[model samples]
Target chain A: MLKNRTKIKVKGLNQERAINNLSKTIRIYNFSRKEHNISEFEVDYNNSKHIKKMLEGQGLEVVSLKSRGPAFFIRDFFKRGGLIAGVIFVLIFYILQYSFILKIEVWGGEASQCNLVKNFIEDNLDSKLKHNISTEELEILVRNNFDFVSSVSVAFVGQSIVVNLNPSLLPDEMGTGFSPLVSEYDGMITEINLIQGTLNCSVGDIVQKGDVLVYPYVTDSSGKVYEVEPKADITAQVWLSGQEIHYDYRILTYRTGKSKVQSQVLLGGLVIYSKTPDILFEDYECEVYTKQLTKNLLLPFKLKKTIYYEIETEEIIEPFEEVKEEIISKARQKALIFSDKNDIIIDEKYTLSEGGGCHIVDYVVTVSKNIGG
Target chain B: MFNFFNEIKNKASGIDYNLLNEYNIINLSGKLLYVEGHQGVTIINSDMVAFKIKKGRVVVEGKELVLSELTSNTLLLQGVIIKVEIF
Candidate 1:
């Protein structure tokens, strides 16, 4: 048996002393939830306020001071009137919310028509939400409202209502019979994947464009031929070729306006006066003019006037292997235009000729692709 | 000293003196100790708690010692109890 007691929790340092003091002051019982610097205990209901004030005087925080008994529960129930009212409101709202159809869904209708029907349902949802309209009544109302719609069914499914409708539609035309699968390009058949069809041709067979590979009819074990829509995947090795002619070397000229001039006088096949090498441009197109200084052919005495124009030259030389690879990649890209997305290249060979001041490259890529209808 | 009073009461009431000689009935199970005969909590701390009995005091030594239940006659001490001493 337990009497109604006031449960108190105090927060401060030296909680041990606080608990000991409360035990001595009042008859404290049911000590629990003890931690470092925090204590919880219960005292007599009449002494709760006095104990709380006594602990406060000692600078300890009275964290919680509450009563634990039937009397306290009754007192709290009347004190928190707004809380009880809000709880009741929520319970009633939950029940009413689930009972009403919040949304209407159309299963067999075009997207725009579904939206139109939904809008129509929403406009009249006030009465439906209030339980004034039933599912059967709503179905008949929808059938009579829309002349194009014939069969209508409105069913309550959980929180929403589903409407099944069939609108009047015109009959469709007859479909054409299935045709035999044919090759789109000329190649040698390498592999054939047949899911459902009659094989008209086998592997290793050479086929041209529009050659039939699978027939539209399949024969049963009893020899009864039935027309079928053939389903198959055919693979054939077709060669795609691309060629490019490139010059063996490329020449580039730089744009430079700087020039330098040099004049020299020579005697007896020996240099008498000349400009130093450092004064001349490293690379230039030089123009030279020579005049006979002495009229002696054996001595060869001459005055030489030279003009050097400064020019900046930048040369980029790619390795032969890299250039060959670049050409092959470009050729492969060009050949890919003639192939389909599902084609897988099995073999690739390129013929390269590097002579006669030009490079001739020819690429042939053999790929397997689906060709049957 | 209280044994003389207990002997007189036992002779007059036909009660066994051995049961009354047991000052504090300590029942220790794992982390919980129930002291049936406790006067009051003398000292309570996270590491230790001391209770005053009839003639002596009982000190509980452990980590995170808590007075889970407390009354004038019974005390429930909860924590990792290492030892208990009656002085």
Candidate 2:
């Protein structure tokens, strides 16, 4: 067993003489006397009583005799095992909490698909739970096992595992049975090439939305009608229009370089402490940012900072030509979203008008694209 | 008498005290004092401490002087050492 130690304060006017006498009587493990006449030293706990008696006999004061070191702690721990038992229980509880899987959640799949994934994981990876499981390995395994799963990700929320999967695109064989190729937009067919079905609309034929371009039903030579899913390559000249309206005079908010910052701490969704004050600026924008204290540990404590910036609005008038150009550019960009790379822009038209201090611009773009479905 | 013993010990160990400077007293920024190759500590008080070397005695005067460590021949003292006297 390690020897127990104690620190005793020796109070006297002559610290040197006291230290000298104490050193002669009892072994001083360590001693320090700083600026004051009082000095403190550590001695063996067993010899403390004799040292105290010796010091008192010499008309000196020995105060604050306290046991130190792990020896006393070990003795107390064995005497009352409740503290040690509680600590052991807490350690076991945390170990179990982090080790076992409490819940398994699956996302981004049909009910049946999710159930299949869950069952697969439980059957294949259940035995490996005794050891640490790598989420990257699990994700790769899941993605490789399911053909429909385009991507998979595995995440751990405390003891629960969440699996997210993305489904792949459907195959061509899953198309509607005996469905004809219909026009997706109102346009005139500019070119047509039929693979299996009879062409219903010829080139330069005006067609409406939902009109069939290629008929899936064909009449055989024996007066028998058969059905087949239509396949075709039909190009149509489609007219697309977009409009944008911009004000010639507008009020814009500008930062005035005046701002105030406030800090706060939230515990369990409640504000525990804050140094924030009520906003004094009438026209101001507030930006709120929050930082979590313990990440990935399920702690409900966070520090929040909010900054308010005072703003001033100014009215400015824009030139008609500049506003018109901006509106036309915006309208053209909007129309381009509907056209594809191979599509040809056959014609473009722009119209501009002014009313109510606003410049209104309308644009029409004619594109030749494959609009068959 | 101490020097005579040290000379005999150095000879037996094949060491030269003159070249080696047997006793080394280093003051670190007036905060710590490192004494190497010391014989022993003779007096220790709150204000001063004295160590016996081969040639003479080294007395360190300071406030709240603490003998941080003591080994067979080396001593480390830490405090606000104001003065160091050798006699």
Candidate 3:
């Protein structure tokens, strides 16, 4: 049985001691780990008395034996510093997160304005700064400089920044305290509603210039029954005819342009010039440019750019009227995109328009539409 | 010397004399000493014995003084005998 004894672990003695006495029935008890190895050594005394004489012959220093017991694993004990270091690591990790960003709150009159204020706070005051700053001071700095922000309140909770700002609160421009929306473009009226004011134009009635679509009424809706003295500004849409001109020039050349070989590495929305290789041009002139593609991890990969090179080659062929037809088709497509952007519904077919010196054809287009007044 | 032998004979006769005398070969200094049934060998350091079997003709060879106890199966040799050339 292993008891309260210490094990003197002789590092160099374990190897020879293991193979020396294989038959000796003895145990080397290691009290440190509470373990032991047992063996037996034979002493044949009945056959020859000389064996007994040799048993008491010489003396040699025996190495300390280890404890031979079943409970050998009790020696695995924790050191004092291990527990202390574990607690200290946890404490430091918690302090770092709590002492930096505790709380962040943003307030703006409009949600979009609040979002903008949040982004500004994140960019400027979210991270750890090597300075001792007060919440009141930051609030004063924000409120004084920003014209769009009417007021701002800043407070610190633990390690958080609580910021409240008025983003929707606009300064009163007129004494009436109402902002009006006028007609952005001239168009014919399709419908009208008197949501907040007396509408000037009725159904099928056309209105023009500076018509109010919604406003505060000076009188009630029931009182204006007989003599209509315009008590409210009216929002009306006036129809107008508008013309849009579009020019589309498509040089129908073969895909043979060769771009110059150029490579630029893009990192964090910034381009870094890395390498540029020359283009290989055969009998046909070609252009090739290579751009260095990079991942978010800032590793660069190869990217190839190709441009078809075209050269003027004279051929003994009869000229056909195919270029004019292709020009008209390209012009119509360009004119449609232009008309759609202006909210003008096209009614008439596209025809040729005046072009200066360029071979590009111009198409005249007209559209009629109703727009908000 | 006469008084010493008489004293030894009186002491030997006085005890319950077990006159069991045996002899064995001793390989000492490369010389084999043979003993008859009368020359009984007494091993001083009997624990210094090396071999077990002691009967018949035995051979022993070593560098150090290897002592062996003579039994009915083997013989005892006590000396720095280099080799035992059995005849």
RMSD of each: 26.1, 32.7, 28.7
lDDT, candidate 2, A287-372, per-residue tens: 99999976656657889999999999999887777656667999888877778898899999988887888877788899998988
* 2 versus 3: better TM-score goes to: 2
Q: List model 3 lDDT by residue over A75-105, tens digit each.
A: 3323456766887899998877666765567
lDDT of 3: 0.43
Each candidate's DockQ: 0.03, 0.02, 0.02
Q: A1-373 in candidate 1: lDDT tens per residue?
A: 2567887888887654566555444665545546666767777788876887889877799999888787887778878979889988999999888777677788788888777777777776656563665778778777766645668898888778898889855222212377888888888888888976689878898899898888777777967465676778887888888877665466565648877778788886578899845545567787798899887777878998887777777655544565777877777777777887778988988888888667778888889877775
Note the residue pairs that clash in candidate 1: none
Per-residue lDDT of model 3, residues B1-87, tens digit only: 575334554676555434322233443346433232312212122122222222423233443333222222333354555554332
Which portions of model 1 show Cα errors greater than 4 Å? A1-6, A9-65, A68-75, A89-103, A119-126, A143-153, A156-160, A164-373, B1-87
Q: What are the lDDT scores of the predictions, listed in order?
A: 0.73, 0.78, 0.43
TM-score list, all predictions:
0.26, 0.33, 0.23
Which runs of model 2 end up more than 4 angstroms from their true locations? Answer: A1-186, A197-230, A254-269, A275-283, A287-312, A322-326, B1-87
TM-score of chain A of 2: 0.39
